[model samples]
Target: MTASVLSRAGADLSTARESLARAAQRVEDLLGALPVPGLRSLEQRDRAAAAHNEVRAHRVDFMATHATEVYDELTGGRTRDLRLDELVEAAAGAFPGLVPTAGQLAVERSRAQADKEGREIDQGIFLRGVLRCDLAGPHLLTAMLRPTTRALLLLPDFQRTGLIEMEAVRLERRDGVARLTMCRQDCLNAEDERQVDDMETAVDLALLDPAVRVGLIRGGEMTHPRYQGRRVFSAGINLKKLSAGEIPLVGFLLRRELGYLHKIRRGLCPREPEQWHAPYLDKPWVGAIDTFAIGGGTQLALLFDHVIAASDAYFSLPAAREGIIPGVANLRFTRIAGARLSRQVILQGRRILATDPEAHLLVDEVVEPAAMDDAVERALTRLDGAAVVANRRMVNFAEESLADFRAYVGEFTVQQALRIYGEDVIDKVDRFSGRSE
Candidate 1:
C-alpha cells in the first residue's frame, strides 16, 4: 500500500538490475570461461529480453516506488488518508491561524491539486498518446494518471532542494489590462529565513518581472489572513517540514541584500540574505500570496505592496521566545499594528489579533477562499504599469554609503569565531605551523 512495502519487494529488482549490469560486464568473462566465441542461438533473443525486463523491472520498481514515496513524503505522511473528498473539504474550509501564511497553505493546496490531477488522469481512458513506453501499459497509464509526474521527472531533483523553480509566471493581458495566472499548486512553504528569501525573490519575479504580469497564489488555513491574502499574487511561505536553516533562510534571502554577506562565514546574523540585481522593487504592483505569515512569514508578506487574503488569514511574531529578535519585518509590523499589538505579538509569542480588522490593513482585500484569484485580478486593474527606476540612483548611493559589507561581516565573524574558539583559531594555526599549542 505504501512505498515502503513496495521498496522491500522491489529489492528483487535491485539484485536483478545489478546482475544485468554485471551480465554486460561478464560477456568477456564468459568468453574467457568457455574459451570459445560464446553460446549462440534463439536463446539470445530471450536473453536480451530477460535483461531488458530486468531493467524494466528495476525501472518500474524505481518509478512506482519513487513516485509513491514522493507523494507520501511531500504529503507529510498524510497520503495514507489523502482522498479527493478530504482535499476539497480542506480547501474550502475556513481556516486561519492554523497556519501562519498562505504560502504554507498554498503548498498544501498544490499537493492536493497534484493529487487530484493524478486521480483524474488515472480515471481518463484516452491518455495513451503521450506515454513513452507501451511495454508496461500500466506505467504508461500511470504516467497519464499523474500528469505532474512528467514535470517531476523533468526536474527530478526538486525533492532535495525544497524549491519549485517556475519557468514562467502566468500573466494575461486582456483588453489592455494585465492579470496573473496560477501555476501548479504543490509548494514547500518554509518559515525559515532562507526559504522566506526564496519566496521574496519569487515575488519580485512575479510582480516586477516584465516577463510576468500576474501570478495566482494559493494558501493554507494556517496563515495570517493578512499575509494569506497575498496568495492572490504568489505562493506564500509554507512551514511544513521546513528545517531550522530553511526558516531563517526564507527571511534572510528576502530581506537582506546578498551583497551584505560576509566573505568569511559570519556568526552575527543567523544567515545572509541573497541579493538580487534585477530590478523589481520599483514596480508599484508587486503582489503577495501568503499563508502562515507568522514570525518570518508575516515579515515576507509585508515586503510586498499588494496582498489578497481569505477570510481565515492569521498573523503573529514569535521570535522573542527564541531569544533572538526578528529584524526583518517586525519593524513594519510595529508601525502597522502599533506599540500594543506589536508588544503582544512579540512578547506573547502566540496568535493574538489574526482575525481582527486591524490585521486587515496588512492586506488590501479579503474574500471567500474561492474568490481569491478574482480579488487579485481586480486589484491589478488599478495599476498604471509604472515602476520605480529613478530609485536605482538612490539605491546606488545608499550602497556606496554603507560600510564595506564583507569587512563588516568579516569583523563580526572574526570576533565571534575567535570568541567561540576562545583560543582555537590561533592555536590551530600556530600548531599547524609547528608553534606551541
Candidate 2:
C-alpha cells in the first residue's frame, strides 16, 4: 500500500481506538453512578446492575484489545491479520472471560447508531420516507397492502381518523373493551413499519383512555382461501421489506423496543427518577390468537396478560433461522416458558402447537376457532377491571417490574443492533429473500 494510504489506515485505527477508550470510560462512569438496589423493586436493581456489569466487561475488553492493535500497527509490526477476539483472548488471564469479541464491538457500534437515529427520527421524517417508498413489491401488487401508509401520507391532518381507517390494524372501542385488531388479512397480518406504528398508537390509546377497562388484542378476519373467514393472527415482521432493504434492521428493532413494546410495558404516565424505572401500565391485556403467530407475532403474544388460542392455532419463534434475536424473546420466554423451552424454541426453531403441553403452559386457554371471540369476551368479563388493575400492580411489583423489563430491553437493544448492522445480516436477508442458497 502507498504511504498516504497507510497513513489514512493508521488514522482510522487511531480514531477507532480512541472511540473504544472513551466508551470504556463512559461505561465505568455509568457503573459508578448506578443507584443502589433497595428493598422495593430489588429485582429490578439487581437486573440493571447485572446488565451494566456486562457492559462494563465488554467495554474493558474492547478498549484493551483495540489499544494493543493501535500499538502494534504504529510499531512497524504487521497488524493486518489481528482479530479483536484474539487480542482479548491473549489478555484473558488478566480478566478471565472478560474478552470482548468482534461481535461485541459491532453491537456497541450499533447501539450508538440506534441512539443517534432514534433521536433524529423523532420528528417522523425517516418514517415518512419509508412509508412513501414504492420499492416494496407487496404494496404495488395491491394498494391495500399499505392502507396505513397511504392514509398517513394522504391525510396527514386527521392522524386519529387515518389511524382508525388503517387496513393493517383496526382500533375499536366498544362497551369498555378496547379491541386492537392486527389486520392486513391479505398478508396474514405481517407487520411493516406503518403497521407497527398504527398498533403502537392503538395500544397507547388503550392504555391512556380511562374508559378502556380491558384491552383485547386479536387478528381481523381473513378472506384469503387458505384462511377464509378465519383469523390469521400475524405472520411476523415484514420480511419482504427487510429483504428489499427498505427497513433497516437496527432501526426496526430499536423502534419495536422503544415504541409499541415500551408503550405496552410502560403507560403514557411519567417514569421514576432513574431512567430505567418505568411504571407498568395497569390495564390487563388479552390476546386472542387464531391461525398462527409466527416470529415477532409470538413475541408480542408473550407480553399479553392473558392468551386464548384457537385449538388449531400455533406459535413459533424463528429468529435463529432469520439470524436475529426475537427482540426480547430470550428474556420474556425464559421467564414464561423456562430456560430450556426458550432455548429449544429460539435455538432449535421448535414450533409450539396450541394443543402441545408447552403451549398450554404459555397460553391460558385453547378453544375452537369459532369460540375464540366468546372465549376472549368471557375471559375479559370474568376479570373486574378495577380489581385487574390493582392485581396487576401487585403482580408486577412482586414479579416482573418495569426495571426488569428495561434491563432485558437494555441488553436486547444493543445485541440486536449488532446483528442488524453486521455482515451476518446481509447474508441472512439474502437467504430470507431467496437471493442466496
Candidate 3:
C-alpha cells in the first residue's frame, strides 16, 4: 500500500479532483447563464434555475464522496495518523493547488492552542474568515492540516559541496556562533541558482548543527570596481544570468521560494515533536548588514529574527523598476512597515536608509561600519543562552500566528510563478545597460 500503490492512488485522486472542478465550473456557468428575474418568462427562468441547482447539487455530492475516497485511500483505511509524505499527498487530493509554505507544520498546533484557550472557531467559518482576511486559500488549507503530516526523515548529515569550496559561500563556526557569509562579491553578491544553492546549503549547515546556538549572515569583500574594497551585503538576483537567457524566471522563483525564502522563514533543523508549536530554528538568526542590502538582500533582512546594520547601510527593492516582482517582500514587508511603506519600497523603488525610522523598525541596531563586529557580538549576547530557543518561541506565539506567514508565502509563490511565464517581464534589465570592461 506504499510505493507504487500510493503513486497510482495519487493519480486517481488528481483525476477525480479535475472532474469535480469541471463539474463545479459547469454548475457556475449554468447559474451565470440564467436570465435575470423579469427578463424572461417565469417558467423559463425557473427551469434554468432548476437545472443550475441540480448540477450544483451533483457537484457538491461528487466532491464530498471523492474527497472521502482519496483520504481513505491515502490513509489505507486505518484511520490513524499518516506520515508527512502521505499527508502532503492526501492534502493535494483534498485541496487543489496545495503547496508548501512557511511555518507549515505549526498550522494545526496553533489552532489547537486557540481551542484550548477558548478562542477556537468553527473550521469552515475560520477558513472563510481567513479567505475574507485576504490570505491565500491553498496556504490556509495547508496550514490547517500540516501538523497532521509528519516527515519520515529527520535531520540529515551535511556534506560540503564543491560550490562552497569555490568561495560562493563561506561557512565557519567560532565558539557557539556560526557565520554563513555570502562570498560571491564579483557582482556585489548577486545570486544565480548556483550561488543561491550554495547559500542555502550554508544556512542549513549553520542552523542544523547542534553545537551552534546563534547563526550570523553577512557578506564578503566586494570585487566590483564601484564597490571594490568594500563589504556589501547583496545586489539581489543575478542579472547576468537573465541577460544571457540562462535562467528561466519560473525556475529562479522556485529556487527563491523553496531554497532560500522558505528556509529563511522555517529554519533548517531536525524535525522534533515540539516543532509544530515552534517551527523556527532552534537558534536565533542575526543578519549583519553593511554597505547595501538591495532587492533580495532586503528580503533576507526581513526574514531574519534580528538585524545589525551599519550606519551607512541602505535597503531597496527595485523589482518594479526592473519589471519584475519582489515576490516575498511584497507579502512579508506589509507586516513590518504597514501597507503604505511596503508599497513605496516595493512599487516605487524607495530606498530605506538605516537611520530612517522605518528601517530602524526592521533592524535591531545600527552601528558605525567599524562597530559591526561589536554590534554582532551584542546581538548574539542577547540571543545566546540555554533558554534562547524557548524564549524566541514565546515571542513568536505572542507576535503573530505562523498561519499568516504561510498564507502570504503561498500567495507570493503563485503570483511569482505567473509573472515568470507572462511576457519577458523578468529579464527587463539588459546586461549591457552599464558594465565596466
Considering every candidate listed, which one attains the maximal TM-score? 3
- The alpha-carbon lDDT assigned to residue 87 of candidate 3 equals 49
Measured on C-alpha atoms, candidate 2 has an lDDT of: 0.60
Candidate 2's TM-score: 0.62
Residue ranges of candidate 2 with Cα displaced over 4 Å: 1-163, 249-251, 270-281, 422-424
Per-model TM values vs. the true structure: 0.37, 0.62, 0.63
Cα lDDT of candidate 1 equals 0.36
User: On residues 1-437, what C-alpha lDDT tens digit does candidate 2 reach at each position?
Assistant: 89998788767655655564565456546534654222224565565556545645544444333443332432224322212123233333232223333344344334422121111111122122212233321121122111223233433323333235465778777777778888787778887777776776677666655567888888888988888888788998776566554454334565665456655543444233542543444478888888899987898898778899999988999887777778777877888889899989999999999999888778999999778878999988876467777776677566666556545654554466456544565567667667566
Write the residue-wise lDDT of candidate 1 on 1-437 in tens digits.
Answer: 69897787557544544553454344323323331112334465355435433443433343343333323332343323322223222322321111113343343334321111111111111111111122222222222122122233533333233234543233333433333333323442433343333333343333323343333334333233444334422232332322111222112421232211110011111111442443112333434443445554465456444666666656666554433344434445676567777777777776633356676657776676577657766766554343423343254335332233322322232122222112333233234334443
1 or 3, which is superior by TM-score?
Answer: 3
lDDT score of residue 386 within candidate 3 = 62
Q: Which ten contiguous residues of candidate 3 have the minimum total lDDT?
A: 113-122
Query: Order of candidates by lDDT, top first?
Result: 2, 3, 1
